[model samples]
Target: MISSVYIHIPFCEKICAYCDFCKMFYNEKIVDKYLDELENEVNSLYRGELIKTIYIGGGTPSSLNIKQLERLFEITDKFKRNNFCEFTIECNFSNTTEEKLKLFKEKGINRLSFGLETTSNMQLDFLEREENLENTKETIRLAKKLGFDNINVDLMYALPGEEISDLNKDLEFINSLDIEHVSCYSLIIEEHTKLGINNIENIDSDLDYKMYQTICGFMKDNGFNHYEISNYSKEGYESRHNLVYWNNEEYYGFGLGASAYINNRRVSNTRSISHYLKGSYLLEEEILEKDDLVYYEIMLNLRKSSGIDLEKLYLLYKVRLEYNELVNKGLLVLDNNNLYIPEDKWYISNEIIIRLLEGIVYE
Candidate 1:
């Protein structure tokens, strides 16, 4: 039962310096054509599962005009949703409007995620993104007034020349917003992004780790639960859509450059807009073998603080992983057959996960 769906709108009003996602500048005519293709893609592929969560991410889904948004919602309306469906759309403060919020409410969008990144004007300029603090405050107020209770805002840290003080300021502003969730990310200089092209490098590794610690401490002090590696939310406000990915569950991914996992196969759609517009949706599919499934299960399940259910893994895959070594070394915690990395050691989780996988033994 693939009970979740992710839709990608690959158009943005402006490209950020750090973005490497599949995206292009917004064009009304092209958007209309894209929506038409999206309709075709959804109608052809969806299997009529009762969707519990539907996330419309971007390239800024809120950048669309009213008519285009209406069309987009019309296409999404084809899905069968229950009374508890969590519908989310990513928005930018510069583009989101009260009218659009009203439309989203009417269409059953219960969650709104805004990309604030950072409130620092200098950092915003460096990232080539636009945001007005007053506007952001106003927009959130309006969304709340319009009955939007579940909202998320993103924060970026560890940029070149950024200090702990800068990160604290960003965290303070985000806390002031009184929103439900926050996603903090360290700056990664991807090879193809503007930052990489300009030879801009990331901050020092030690400073980056320190900044991450600051974020965790601040969120915890402010009554937020560090639910995942980069996500914190007020209790019961965790992102259900993202949990599908972390839990290694199957889902439907529609639109250009999207990926999906279904029936033990991983599927990826083409990134080229021309190909996508022409109905050439699929790019590749990899059938997962038993070993691949085990690897994925271990890697994904350990991401949560609750950790893996060891008994369930053994029963399902007939593979018993002995991690007593890691637990003894204090790199992992085993409580009641659940294995997890301590939150303090999450900065080096990748290394721990690698070590655990290296010690895997087949039954």
Candidate 2:
């Protein structure tokens, strides 16, 4: 049973320079049409199964007006949620108001992911993003007053000119909040983004690695567990929706540019809004063979600090890995049944995962 659902809202009031996600300028006419198509897609695919987690991610979901958001919520009313269900929505400080947030609380949205890429005004300007830290504090305080506790704040580090001090300030600001989660990412210069177009150079690899280590150490010192790559949370607050992806479990993804994993096939919706509205939703689907599935399980599960269960992998996929070689090379560790990369080696996890997959295939 698919217990998770991810909804994508592809409209943003202000497009950041570094973002390459499927997004567009917010238009009321287009939003209304998009929501209508979104409803259709969900209704067609959803089996009315009880969902344990539902995440509405963005292009700034808070960019939508309260009424539009309400309409969106009304559509989701068809899905049944139990007491343990975690319903989260992404928000931006500029558009998230007390009234809008109050409406969300009433509608059963128990969690919020605020996109505050950086607290420094200089970085904000460089990224073509706006952040009012005071306003953010006020909004989060209001959420706490309204009995909402689970929250995730996104932070970006390792910009073209980012320094360790700048990152410390961001971390300090995050510590000030009563939020439960943090997802910090290094700036990636993706093609077609304003940053990329402007020929922004990434920070030195050594410096970038230092910044990553600094953030990890600071977050850990502040009592947050580095539960997964790029994510830290107070115990028991790890994002269930994101875990659905990291666990390599099947899920329903609805709306433009959303991807779903169902029936061992990975499917992504069309990125074009016009095509989506015209009922051409799916862009591509990949049917995973047995080898592909096992590789994915290793790739995704190893992202967590807890790592993968080797015994369970053999039972589920009947594939044995040459993890012993990885252990000999200090690239991986096998503690009885669990195969995990040491925290120090996690920075090179992408390279390590590729090598491990190659080595395991030879087994």
Candidate 3:
């Protein structure tokens, strides 16, 4: 039951300094051609499955003009979803408008995710991001007017030279908005990004941990569930599409630089726009062995608050882990056969997950 779908739109109005996603400048001709190819790809591969969730991630899906966005939605018409579908599109503060929001509502887009990585004007300028605070407020107002309640915003902290006061202001501003979901991520200076090339360094580890703790406390006080590592949500407002990945469920990923797990294989699409335009679609394919898949299942499930079902793990891998070994170390909690990392220990979950997996030995 491949019930989730992701479509990539690799065009952005202006590139952000921190972004490392596969993206290029928005061009009318290129967008038209890409939509045509995107439609063809959907038509060719989709098995007409009823999708439960659809996430249109980007370079910036909102960068496209009305007609271009219409064509993009037209491509998605081939697939069907049920009444509980969570259809989301990523938008930028600069490009979102009343018309765009209305168009999204008309197309049955129930969720809107905005990239407001930080609210501080200084941080925004340093990231080369220009935001109109009044306009952003208006955008949220319009989205709510259009009956969108499943709204999400991304906030980045642990910035170089950023103060705790700066992060508190961001938290206060987001709490003011009636948005239901939030994703808080620590700054990672990845190679190939402008910040990386400029020799920028990350904040001190202790400072980053402090920021993370602050965010967790704030969200908890604000009646939000710290559902996943970087995600917080109001009750029943969790991101279903994102959980598709963390739950180790299969789904389709389309467009250049997209990756998919299906037919027992991990597949990635070509990252080069020229190559994709020239019909060079695939970049790599790895057929998963049973043990490889089982390991993936464990790693991904442990990322969620619900944790891994130990019985299911045993049934799948035939490995019986000594539960007390991890529980005694204050690393894992066994509740109703679901093994999970405690909230305090989620920061170092990678090391604990590695230790737990050591109990498994494939035949």
Best by lDDT: 1
lDDT of 2 by residue, 119-158 (tens): 9888888898856777988999988999899999999989
lDDT of 1 by residue, 54-113 (tens): 999989899999999999999999999987999999999999999999999999999999
Residue 186 lDDT (model 3): 91
Model 2 spans with C-alpha error above 4 angstroms: 361-363
Query: In each prediction, how many residue pairs overlap at the backbone (N, C-alpha, C within less than 3 A)?
Result: 0, 0, 0
Q: If scored against the real structure, what TM-score would every candidate get?
A: 0.99, 0.98, 0.98
Q: Write the per-residue lDDT of candidate 3 for residues 68-105, one digit (tens) a residue.
A: 99998888777897778899999998999889899999
Q: Quote model 3's TM-score.
A: 0.98
Q: Which number leads on TM-score?
A: 1
Q: What lDDT does model 1 reach? A: 0.93
After TM-score superposition, what is the CA distance of residue 149 in candidate 2 from its true location, in Å?
A: 0.7
RMSD of 2: 1.2
